[model samples]
Target chain A: MSSSSPLLAELIDALRCLPGVGAKSAQRMAFHLLERERERGLKLAGVLEQAMQRIGNCSRCRNFSEEPVCALCASSSRDRHVLCVVESPTDLAAVEQATGYRGQYFVLLGRLSPLDGLGPRELGLHLLTERLAEGEVEELILATSPTVEGEATSHYLVQLARAGGVKATRLAHGVPLGGELEYVDRGTLAHAFGSRQSVE
Target chain B: MSSSSPLLAELIDALRCLPGVGAKSAQRMAFHLLERERERGLKLAGVLEQAMQRIGNCSRCRNFSEEPVCALCASSSRDRHVLCVVESPTDLAAVEQATGYRGQYFVLLGRLSPLDGLGPRELGLHLLTERLAEGEVEELILATSPTVEGEATSHYLVQLARAGGVKATRLAHGVPLGGELEYVDRGTLAHAFGSRQSVE
Candidate 1:
């Protein structure tokens, strides 16, 4: 849209940097900030600037952090023996929120996607290898997504765990708890059926 | 969600000031920025701060502007004899983009809603009255939405136009273009039927 004000145009254009925000949504956000939420918008700008400049990855787990090490990785209360590996901070957050796994975490920051130039080095596998070789961790839980890349990343991590004499396990792939069998997609249903476990 | 970093938490909280952004979307936006778009995020912060601090209402038309007057109001190419009044700058942009209108514009910035504390004064109708009284405008177009408050605002503007001895016109309201009669809402169909006109 042709905005009469150059600053308004710039604001709208800048808002598009956010995920899922397009031209119309950006315009709406700019107008909203201008019309009603100028104070909060200013606060957002301040916070955004601070986050972009100060927030860094945890030196140990590679999760986002303002300190040298993230709080989760630095906490002494968390278990050090069982390490859950996730692809990104978002997935780590999902696991933290949905499950009761209170062990330590290792954030890969990305899956092993060679086409996207993401490899073991980019994912900070060396740090994970060092952690595993420290002889503290007894188990490595592969909690990456079930996508092809996620599986490959998990498989690679399993080898590293084996080399370090740590037990490696994968998150179960099956139909969701509430999902009906008939409505489940063929791939998930087939995988669930093939991996059917004996009733405990 | 429990963010490991306080700055990350603050960033997510601040992002919710945007229109339509909730907790989940804010978290996603924060992570997306942290993970891949830190440079753009910082750029957005700079632009957002500049926009919030520098942008002000146009002295003549009440549209957003960084200077004393907006580009549209300052343009000599636009006709000064006809003025289109809109509820907001977004509406003004919509009219400017969707139509061939070349006249000047007056942005109310809001409609007449007493419960929401939006009155004629808040809408900048005083400036508009002064503009109409200047005798430069021959026609005052009421382009407000057809909601209860918008209708009331338009009715009040009509009186202002009459008092200023200027002709007043309203946007044609009926079934939307390409809308089938069967699918059109009852109120719109009834209004369209009542205001049926001959093809010119």
Candidate 2:
């Protein structure tokens, strides 16, 4: 028996564009969409298109939103004086979900990747500069990833903040919660040891 | 930052219906669709709807197809005297992909599970019986799974074929090809030892 029809094969190929979906998973997803839940499949399509249309870059923070200014940036309860810069909306969401941050966020949308043609301009660094020049922010916390690109972006932002007369800080790096000492890398272990906090 | 917009959240939820897709994977898929592959995402939806509408059960073999009689049953080169019964279209495709089997197939669509109310009628056993009575099938090959339900279904099928005056056969089972002896289970080891064949 042939594994697929033309339409189904096309659908499977398209499904491969999704992150982490390989050929086998794409096939399974295509079969699932065709055989069991056509309604849900169609709904996903509608939602994708709707989201693309409704969710544009937030003018202030570069996060996705339905309007020019997102609800988070428009909220009055958040301290405008404290700004947390994250690499992506997903990272910002994670920090928010952890529930300690009451500051506003500026999403980089991407990190500086010179090889990939993603520079400071590509990451909306000019817009960030404008925000910094506004002088409303007193503290800038860098929450980018610990990767090389993330570190470079964070360093660049820290310098930019200092030049704008704002205090700059970074999220701490160390062994993760419940992580074993044996599994910690040499660089991370050294950093953690150097930055040890006093119990008092 | 909020993790999702309403439309994006809906897409993520809908994507969870696929096999192996959990909350995190669904979220990633939703982001991939909205941010990178909007066209492909929309194309998947269209193709899914089209395939669902076009593909139906083949009248003869009960496999999914765009027509009543599938391409396989409509083919003139296939042997009509031999039939391979399988549990699903995916299984049928797998056997075809493995090669060497050129006979026609009868798809059960499902197996017998009384607890779930999937009885003989649900598995189209009566239709299988009718096909056996037509007398064109000289050999009925059972290719259902080797689970408990699969064993019961195979036994019922073998008995039904015998009563219909047709020769019934099962695929050989034992240690898999190139399998490690130490990993082989006791029952399979016993069966392999008992059924050892001559090298000559």
Candidate 3:
């Protein structure tokens, strides 16, 4: 740190806040910004500040939005009776991009990790229950992830949906398309085999 | 992109300005900054702006420094007569960290890449020659990288130094310490064998 200027040291320390960026990577990033792309660096600072100040969570869906209601939740074209639950906003975006589903979405914000002090409350299950209690939602689709925490969160929510007299469903687990059976994990292969459907 | 909020999209685009960061990594970084470390993100923006505005080339060695002359060049104890020419400030820092060399440094800022239109002027070789003409410098150490461009630059500088009646030296090329003979590249092994030093 003594080898670099105070400005450089501060930039490097700030860059380290980025996920997966270590000390060496931070230094390289700082140098790239300072020496190679100063204008872009300045623009990045402006955009970061503006975005941070303007962005917030959608009050209902828990996805990112500048306003209280996100675009997806506010849209009339989306099916209000069907709701998709996901572990994060990124997952919600991926689903929207890759699928033809036109249902409303509720982002869990994170999966339930009781060990990390995350539970039903952290996943915003109370808000979800409130939404379900309104009696408008008929189907709850769980799309959290394929991980243990995602499964546990889905299980908890499925019970909540059933209690509210709503149908609860989850994404089907199977071998990925174009995947070789030999290369697939044993658990996934077994699950796919056990859940086999008749070919039409 | 259409599904994400405007605030989120702007942040992701800004994050893409970072070196080695792509669209997916940019999205992940944006989400992490917005959802997990907003305060640090704000601080990072501030630090980036401040560093971009303040840091510039050191007047003497052309390395990064906030002051007119860098600490290494300005220090009273360092030998002004022995100057080490390196490709970048990072190289200068590495030499200082790994070696006991007590010499001043001259950063080339780049190397002689003729195809990319880089030549003596681009590498600040004219300024270096002017410094040599002052006659205070007794030796010029060529510490460019081991690439083709670096070798060509070093050879050119050696001729410049010799014309000015100043001694020129280069970092020794050899098999790296702790390197396995079986794994060593052919070029390095040949260089080490050709420059073999006699035992006392």
Question: What lDDT score goes with residue A69 in model 2?
Answer: 83
Model 1 iRMS (Å) reads 1.2
Task: Supply candidate 1's per-residue lDDT for B125.
Answer: 87
Highest DockQ model number: 1
DockQ for each numbered candidate: 0.82, 0.47, 0.64
- C-alpha lDDT (0 to 100) for residue A24 of candidate 3: 86
Against the true structure, what is model 2's DockQ? 0.47
**TM-score of chain A, cand. 2:** 0.90
- Candidate 2: misplaced stretches above 4 Å? A1-4, A32-39, A52-54, A197-199, B1-4
lDDT of each: 0.92, 0.82, 0.88
TM-scores for all predictions: 0.96, 0.88, 0.90
Clashes of 3: 0
lDDT of 1 at B189: 89
Model 3 pairs whose backbones collide? none
Docking class of 1: high
Docking class of 2: acceptable
Model 1: what is its DockQ? 0.82
Residue runs of model 1 more than 4 Å from their true location after superposition: A1-3, B1-3, B114-117
List the pairs of residues colliding in candidate 2: none
Model 3 scores a C-alpha lDDT of 0.88
Tens-digit lDDT track of model 2 for A85-156:
998877876788886888899999899899999999989989989999998999999999999999999989
